[model samples]
Target: MADDPFQSRFAADASLLPHMADLANDRVLVALLAEADYRAASFLDQRLLTDRVGREWMAWDALPDLGAAAAGPHFIFHIGHVGSTLVSRLLAEVGDVLPLREPMLLRTLAQVAERIERPESVWSPELYRTRLAQTLGWLGRGFAPGQRAMVKASSVITAVADDLTGSDGRALFLHVPLPRYLETILAGEASMAETLAQAPARMARLAALLPDFPHALWQLPPVTRVAMSWLCEMATAQRRLPPDDPRRLWVDFEAMLADPAAALMAQATHFGLPIDPARIEAALAGPIMRQYSKAPEHGYTPDLRRELQAQAAADHAPAIAEAIAWVEALAARYTNLADLPILGDQSVIQEVRCSS
Candidate 1:
């Protein structure tokens, strides 16, 4: 490595590497270079995105130890279409916190586990465990004193929760209530299109979860297919998350949106991150709430979303109604899932209580 000013400066900062951000077709690890800090980045995308700066190809043999430099790198595990992104963005607003949203490395590991193939000669579960821990250690390095590192994983990555969190690690399993989740999928053309396009992949994931998932599930109504996918994800969350683990917390999207300050503060407390209540309030009132968390240029407000949902419901009345009915019928069919909110039980409204 040459000693150029930019390279020299960034090299010393152990917080730079995001493990397996670029796993090439040939199994080499390519590093996607960005500024050391992602404070100005967007959370709308699955991965932590930044202005393209440069790239570096790294050999595992040459990889340095980062774990010692890292502080506590907490995780925000969530179900898709929820407000996980919003929570991540708010946390990053604290200036000292580095929030990595959906690192591709974790996703690759999850896929590898499902397929049961070692893509590289040197790759193994133990290798991934060591490399990921070291990378996380580096990520845990706070930009300043007492800063925290947080990772917001994609919902599907719940398959590898054990590897990610390890024993005695902490995580927050986040999801939207069943009705809101269905409406979220049905209300947006993009959402509906994505659901259709990813149907095959979702089915493959469900097959892993439900041993007897019928082959005819694909032939069922599209609405039912989406419902099944949601169920599979929920089941994953429930399975991986230890109900009695004090370190593990469960949250619903509706609760967070209803009370941003309290919810954010509670999450901060849960993760052991130090935050000023005044600063959190300021951030909530500022751009984080006013702008689209994903694409800040587009303004976002509660009223705007409600209006859009109403318009969508009116435009796609039949489809929305069918989707709702399909979910209701499924809920009733599975009496064993009575405790699950999606199963149409009103008592399940606040199963995972947050600190009010």
Candidate 2:
């Protein structure tokens, strides 16, 4: 055996990926990407990468087959509610851009495809990995071979990024929750309360199932789910307070109202996103902002009222009281963008994010 030539080639950079991938383990991928510096600052497109590899590299596992594609690079991604809609809409304004929404279905598919055990929940793991690749494939298929796709993802399936296939596609991931958003989170406890009322009660249950996944790639999702659990718990406590008692929440709605764009912009920038500061300011000036306005019949729920009354004592009560006051104080700050089209453009689904 002259030093096992086949084994050596198997782990070689090219085969290393598919081989390690076949092992049903995502560790190699994680280590490689973290080392690659996804957070590095850059304004240039990856035109040179095409020269190095001869052809473009779309994502490995997630993309659709679009048959024929247009020219230029693409931006794809996953994002939460934190100013992402604004960023995506703005990015769409950029020429030659084909943006994808949450990409939730693909996310579920990836989880199912390479996951250790199939998930029996909302997502279909069996179809996860390839579907995302298929999406990239389809998106890329519509473009030239060397075109790049800047994709923003909803449920971040970074492990599946390399697996995505199509034209030459490289991804830049941005974590949109920034300092201002965190401050708002810390300050606006009532908002948290409101979030709880609206969020699914099953969220807490989902956080506990992380250990069941096959690969470390699956761990990231639960980190988010776990955080949700804490917020939901805190919210449950906040809902128990009386209207007058303060300390139920964290931040102020009045201040948030005065500078909606400013507050939102801080969140956008915090995630290393590229957003126009001027537009952020413009967004605030338009009427219809804040969590929700107070209407006599269309106000707080019974679950909330009881939660507040029950929490009037002990440690949780004060936090909730403060939050309620914070929400009440800013009642005038909200404009309910639900009616206003995105960026003031009411067209196909591309420009609209109207409220329910």
Candidate 3:
């Protein structure tokens, strides 16, 4: 192989080979990656969000398949905004648990297993099964016997919980849907439409290969619109399953972020995890606080806000009214800034939230 001579740094430094070999061997890299992942700065953490997924369950189906029981004590966490990242990062600090962001272990096994058939498209189910077990074994290689670790996964996997649970493993579900998190990223003088527009190009290529889906939807702009569609799709699917299934949990992000100390305590108590106070505080104050504080104070003129509210009301009167009522109810649940005192009217923000 070396005789073929593809000149590169790969040949220059044999040390680099050790890192790759260790990663292939599933030794140093996994733990190192796990630590580096949790320690990453706020928006850049990419723990659960290594892609442009906006940090939620909708991103799960997009991941490579790992057959059954790849992850146990499954944290089918559905989250909204950047705050969910903070929560996840904090959870990793617990000594008993090795908080996996999105582990490549399972998928790596799946890929290798699939190689047996050497097919161009899909692998046989048996190969997938083989790979899945191999991956799970490797995941626990670093853990002390009888020690348990949890996988915090994207909620999109809610559709496949039965495939994931095993007699040896348990599951815990958590939700952290920020009521107005989309606003943080979408509404800053930066139009959601603009963010969505970039998505079509990416979706175009994806649709060609994933013909099971409608290509027409690919025309929808990328970031905001495409992201929103995935959320609705995944969230609706998750809601359909019974809560008793041990397959899911739902959290209102605004509620948790409003008082994380209390919320964190409740979650740890409920989920039966160690409460690592120092880590929790570090995560919250580190990334989430910085991101929200630095978020743009996008100035939308009163005239513009008024025009938008009026237009939204006219376009969908019943839905708009229903949304307003929902907001009122939500405001009561999350008291502080539910209806920002600075706003001219509640209806204005309602238009953005409901976008009816």
Candidate 4:
């Protein structure tokens, strides 16, 4: 290991992960990680930074330019609570993809990108662009020569989806129907808390798109706030990952649940990974599907999720209906949201139910 405090060893060794960026200080926090560490982590954020992991801070300028050899560090952008972590875990089981889930640095970059042009912005336009490029390059490195990096970004990171993935980049935009999204969020105390915590940021993003955005965060009920979170994320996805883009794939989480093998194959093909039916089947049948992905020790299954959603639907029927109506009203008002693909797609929902 090198003794220099300011030099980044990430280029020479992929184990040194760039955990987070300090934009104001012009340095990045790097953590030493191994293949097993990446596999074991549910998130690449502070939770994964334990006392056992070696850490250092490197000047941004000292970070090496490894862009030439970088391949896709592709993306999995989604609306929160939509089983993205599960998808990332299954993909990791497939053997050729390295999954980086919800890296804190991406969230930091997203925050900065939101105000890059404002007076309070921390980085100049030139520096921001340079750092963004460097970050992407750093993320693209994998342990093996042929393995590809797949980033599962946090939900809010979708606000910068366009920046993270340019014209030629590949990604999977995952989401669920409004009614179901509300049910899932409302069913859990922690989920509702997260929804409320993120409401202010979601509101600001929504306001940017819909200037006449009605209702302050406090004015709306909890269900309505959840709906606003969905709109902010889904609208950003629709704008950044257009329907016509060949490189981007739009997948409904319900549709994925309907046929795990098919969905996994489609995603694998999209990312140019080798597809083996046997391996896909094994991954599906393995413990990943049965256990709650974010916390593997807690047992959770598709059936359990359906039961929870059913209870939530029965318990919060009125609020769920109101939330759906609210979203429909916005769709009617905004031309951009009028044709949002999965809003009322009965066929997809029916397929999931039928398969189940």
Candidate 5:
């Protein structure tokens, strides 16, 4: 490495992780991150980039390209509040995995991807593709030779899942049934506020997919607004990683909670990671399971989550029923949404007791 902090050791070292891609400014913010730093931080966004972390911004073109030879940089794409962080934590604990949770750079790229074809787009198609490859190469670097870099993307990043993942790239699409998803989001004031705030953008994305998407964001109540969020994300996943795709694995978060060790083992195999049953067992029994994944100091467990969901469901039963009916109506009208494995499987929904 050179004396210059931003001297472009992106290809050679995993420490210089690209923290943010400022497309408007044509620069990338790179941060020096160690194994401990990656493990300690919940998200690799501006929140985690404290004054203590060494960082600098470099022009986009100045970044060295590692080309198409970068190693495994698989992904975990999930609907929000579905234990995606927990999955990332468990994988990180099992070894041979370099976990990068919600890196803001990817979010920037996803936003750029949404407008790449538009007349007013900042990046031309060629530059966007090149930068996407370069960013992935930078993210693919690992502390050890065989350690695979696994990114658990922010929920909305699913909008560009197809663009981010190559044909050979493997991804786990984590989600829960619609009713459970509503319960989880509606249970928290912050989560509900986020859902409402993001509803318009999500509705726009959903309209792009389903040309006849009928309801406006203003037309829907709070509960259905949350349902629309699920539909938009889950539909994006369905379109991007179809069931026939060999590189994609679909994992239900509820099923994972039921049998975590087995779920972890299966997920490891899906990503071609080396399996250590002992390590998986240790992770399940470890502190990560007991602590809130996004904030380790806060204690949160599956039992607590269930209690919250139950209370939310009971308190808002009428609104929830209306939201479910709204989704069911859409599913019936749209062939693409009709056969969604989560929506179609009554046994799965019934097992969760989402319908009483």
Candidate 6:
């Protein structure tokens, strides 16, 4: 029999090369990347991909209906700086799952969601829904048979969390409590600085959630501003999560670090991944856990992280203290957030509140 184009995974080009979709014009533009450089870059920087990789384009309207295609792809949704990428990388050790780390299409759809309510909007909710469904269908395509697709979405895309994990799909929401979030950001070389710099743009989109939000939030200290963004995203995810839904799960980054193997197995079971007990044991003993999940070249043991966080907390005590206070003050404004496992416990809250 002649070779089917789609069956030839390497030659299918669409399946082999990474692709980014743009919905700017009257039509959608699908740009296929031709190089393997910077596979670790954020989906938002996908345009820079053209500089390194060759490209090919396909108009969105010209494509056939993908709505009826696979719909149950898994997702790793998170607040920024949590260990989501680590979890995604670990999950890929399972033989049957193909993990996609922040696809550009998802970021595009998410950006679309942000502008959905604009006055001069050219896109309607229905159109957005259809496009997302089709785009996800294309992304869900497994590079090889029997391999399921899992996506680690960008934290900003949490704006579309519910839409992405609708009836067909399942997801895990990863986050840390307010104090740890501040600690992680502060410990990083430039993550906190970068987040602070982008506050105006990110806060503009979140203003509707809190009355007089953007202006009010901007008045706060730089540390407090970043903390507010974390709370906003967490609050959004909390509201969208349905009670007693087996398809959705909430995980604490701290807990995962304390006992990684248990966390991985539980997550695997939750996602219905049939990883063998032996394989799970082997993976835990492997080198993946020894290095930083995002920057595999660097070492990132739990002890090292603890030392760094402790040092960071001590060094940035004044700023971290102010940021924690800001978070507690805003907690009442989001009572729904108070019910979360991370935020609800007054003991945990008080502990962090009194820290430093």
TM-score of each: 0.80, 0.33, 0.48, 0.95, 0.95, 0.84
TM-score of 6: 0.84
Residue ranges of candidate 6 with Cα displaced over 4 Å: 1-18, 26-54, 211-215, 242-244, 341-356
lDDT by residue (tens digit), candidate 3, 1-356:
24433213222211111111122333422122333442342322224334432222212122233345334443434432234444555565443555544444343432343354666624466745653553443343223343444555443333334444444344544432222333333433354454354345334433432335443653433333434433332333344333445433444444454456766766665556667777567655554443332132333322343355355445445543343343344345444324322122345345434532
Off by over 4 Å in 3: 1-73, 79-82, 105-121, 140-147, 154-162, 165-181, 185-215, 218-233, 236-242, 275-356
1-356, model 2: which lDDT tens digit per residue? Answer: 12656333322222111101222422112112110222121111232123222332223332122223432224333222233333443333322233443433344444554443544443344444334443443333213232233444433343344455233433333222122222233334664454444334324322232224222223323223223433323222222221123311121222333344554554344333456766555544332132121222234322333234334323344444443333223222333212211111213212111211
lDDT of 4 by residue, 1-356 (tens): 15544344566566889999887788989899998898889899999889999999878777776664455489999999999999999888875988899989998898888889999998888877877887888888888888888999999898888889876789999999888788889889999999999999888889888868776888778898999999988888888888678888888897789888999999999988898999999999999999999999999998888778879989999988888888888888888998785365778777665654
Clashes of each: 6, 83, 7, 0, 0, 0
For model 5, how many clashes?
A: 0
What residue runs in model 2 are displaced by over 4 Å at the alpha carbon? Answer: 1-79, 117-132, 141-151, 156-168, 176-179, 182-356
Better of 1 and 2 by lDDT: 1
User: Candidate 1 at residue 2, lDDT?
Assistant: 54
Q: Considering only N, C-alpha and C atoms within 3 Å, which residue pairs clash in candidate 1?
A: 44-294, 66-138, 67-137, 70-140, 70-141, 71-140
Worst 10 residues of 6 by lDDT: 35-44
Better of 1 and 6 by TM-score: 6
Task: Output the TM-score of candidate 1.
Answer: 0.80
Candidate 1 — which residues are off by over 4 angstroms? 1-15, 19-37, 43-52, 67-72, 117-122, 215-217, 314-336, 343-356
Candidate 2: lDDT over CA atoms?
Answer: 0.32
lDDT of 5 by residue, 41-155 (tens): 8899989778889998988887778778876488999989999999999998886888999999998888889889999899999988998888888888898878888999999
Q: Looking at model 2, how many pairs of residues clash?
A: 83
Candidate 1 displacement at residue 244 in angstroms: 4.0
